[model samples]
Target: MSTPLKPLPAWADVALIPLINVAAAFVISGFVVLAIGENPLEAVQILITGALGDLEGIGFTLYYATSFIFTGLAVAICFHAGLFNIGVEGQAYIAGLGAALAALYLGFLPGYSLVFVAIVAAALFGAAFAFIPGYLQAKRDSHIVITTIMFNYIASAIMGYLLVNVLRVPGQMNPETPGFPWNGRVPQFHEVLAKIGVHWPVTPFNLSFLLALLAALAVWLVIWRTRLGYEIRTVGANPTAAIYGGISPARITIVTTLLSGALAGGMAVNVILGEEHRLILEYTAGFGFVGIAVALMGRAHPVGIILAAILFGMLYQGGAELAFEKPKISRDMIVVIQGLVVLFAGALEHMFRKPVATLLARRTTQPPI
Candidate 1:
């Protein structure tokens, strides 16, 4: 039998490895760029400039990051429970319905009060939708991956039916709800800054960015500092051991999945209430799928998630600029870049770990065994 590889230090495992993976992914992406007769260096400069060169760029990057952060945290929560919940896309979709309904039907409530209700309704909707798969996984020994995949199609069909037959405004061809009341919106970032006499450029960013940060802090506290968190980690590490330690794996599975789905719902509040201020069929725009990569790249940690989200936000904003400036590079090429990152970060994540650990082990004093 092959000898087991040496273990890495905590810093190396959590921070160093992920950074190297991202860098490697980028380097590979550069080669892909070169294949298309584009200057990789110029592309890198353009990406950096477009993502952070001005207030407009920064605002748009953060707006994208806000949605990513919510979805990343949702995936992270499920990761810690040893559950790969891929149904967040559907959960977030249903969540938009809840947020839209609250804003549309609850127009009688006070301004931000209705916003709060929409947020709660969003969480409830997401959680309720997720409960079905969670229930099956816990009780019926069903595979979460399969069920969640099926639910994604189900969600899209349901949303299509509802948007066309029920929510679409009369005499309009678009399948979307009427514009929400002005007060129902979460305050826009530029408007809020303008209120304080700071002239910031207009972007899709809004108060929901602050909420995303708060959610990250809350996830950290809940995951690392609480008894429930300990139980979750314990269960994830080894469900058999957790059962022996008086923790019910079934209960943890249900609760963790619920929390995951709720966080997924928060993405809707960021996009629908904070940005669009209207319910659109394509509002989600694949952010749920992006969250999986964010979670993986982040190593299922809040700090990592924030950084990863921002990096993806940069890619999104910068990629748009890239497509605009370079006729040779299409939007589909940008997706290839993102896919490379995901490939390095997920399936091929451990490709370098053994080599890295071997190197580190050789360098350590008195390490050879």
Candidate 2:
């Protein structure tokens, strides 16, 4: 009698799944473009050209990509630790307020460097806002998803009230805080580059791009090379197993969630400090939700997250242009594409697993001649 062989693990084929999903997404998006009576090839050409055809386009893509990187990393970290941090949006909003206040109130501190104070203030605010949900989850054993969602609503209402009343800039009807001083603004280099015919490829792309790259690298290093990362992974994989191995899953959860919030908070600096230099109502603009998709698409890997972020950023910038150039094609079409991509990607994990397992089982159980 022959012994039964074990099947290969599903994760062994994880690499191919994302690729297949991406290809399918593109095909579906093409169909969508056709359904709207637009030439798929022309639509794709417009997208590529708008995203990367010139220096300005490239800059905008990179600028958006930088913000996505920060938020995406935040989502990725929480996901890796088996926690869902839906509070990134609210945390980022509160952090922006803190940054604006710091710039307005703390701007007069003699000898205090602008960059140092703004960054510290934003990070602290972000950490504090995020820590609330983390504490609740740890102490009360509450569901993070519910707590975070509640916090989002609370933060939005609070921010709206503050922007309209307390933080409102004098003489401006807009519900926004006063713009940051010269010291708080991120330096613009594209103008100088353009004068020399260099045209830096985008208006918004700047040093923040490098900062995002470093952040992604740091996340990868922390998750793959450090002891704390091991604890996080172990805890995520199995709380019971992690507890048996002497790791405190509760502590890991708090730490990971805090780190995730901090990352999201950092995105405010990129926006308020780097580009906008003001706390506007629409400052975050759904980046948090988009980050969730990015995290899922990347499978929680930092490099993959970066790639996914860039792709989404490109789509966002390009889709806007597509709408403008082709009045018949709505920008919402891009949203449909993104939705399809995420839906397929989500299903792919399970779709690939069942078939591969059945095939491996059949292969292992087959009789020999």
Candidate 3:
């Protein structure tokens, strides 16, 4: 007979298990590093130093984390509603077009005004791009996963055309738009710091990082403190029961996905306004997909997502530093490490679940003296 397992404690389910899994992943990764003729302990030190040793490294790490925060929250919201938004990558990409248009046309406006309008444009465009797939799923019963995955390729092609044919800078070989006006640029965080007499190394970290924090706060409020959130969660928990209670699953699905897409679109602001200062092809650089891992590792919670995003961000910046410092460790090796992290944190999450549950069950059933 199968053992009747008790649910894990909150601490174990949320904190302890994830920590153990991450540690296990790193342990395995250390073995791989050793096999490659490198000292895993030294490599770990290099990663920490590279990502957190200086302001410049911290800046880049935070910059990347900002994007991951947007995308992670996007995916988390959709996941909560029983949807898998694989098209966040594409939504973010297409949203850049809207942001670029606002920058180009409203360059005459003051800095704050231009930024505000661009934010609205990006969110609208991203939501609109995601709506078709969402609609197909809700109305026609199309599988959301397949539709969203296909949409990613469509978004890529559309972006390629727009960049090369329409938005290309005059007399420039690169398929990027002309730079945004001075007033249109989002001020970098280092510049703000310098103004306050807190000098730091120049980096792409910008005001958008604050925006990401705000987004996370907003997501928490919406998910835990609002009526619409209740409906979305209800539908996810039990669709037929939600219908019996007069909630429309179709409407909730569409609205939830649109909100998710808009959140994902906000990521473009960090890249285009904060860093690149103009629209560029493939600026997202697969961060959309990485958001999936972030959301999974974070347990689909905003706080967890932020922590996971930072960890991945450290991996990214630190990996670059490691590659530069030790040429023997190729960039591909860093990707392998990241992949292993995702694999353990997500796909193999239940590997220790039964064992932990069994141990807890035994403890709970122990005979008292």
Which runs of model 1 end up more than 4 angstroms from their true locations? Answer: 1-6, 366-369
Candidates sorted by lDDT, descending order?
1, 3, 2
Query: Of the candidates numbered 1 and 3, which has the greater lDDT value?
Result: 1
Where does model 3 exceed 4 Å of error? 1-3, 359-369
Give one digit per residue, the lDDT tens place, for model 2 in 9-108. Answer: 5453445566667767879889888887989889888988999887778778878888888888988888878898888888887888778888887777
Question: After aligning candidate 1 to the native by TM-score, how far in Å is the CA of 234 from where it should be?
Answer: 1.4
lDDT of 1 by residue, 130-246 (tens): 888888999998988899889988989999999999999999999999999987888988899998899999899999888899999999999899999999999999999999999
lDDT of each residue in 193-235, candidate 3, tens digit only: 8899999799999998889999999999998999998998898
Which one is best on lDDT?
A: 1
TM-score of each: 0.96, 0.89, 0.96
lDDT of 1 at 155: 88
Q: After superposing candidate 2 on the true structure, give the runs of residues whose Cα lies further than 4 Å from its correct spot.
A: 1-15, 109-112, 189-202, 352-369
The collision pairs in model 1 are none
RMSD of each: 2.2, 3.8, 1.6
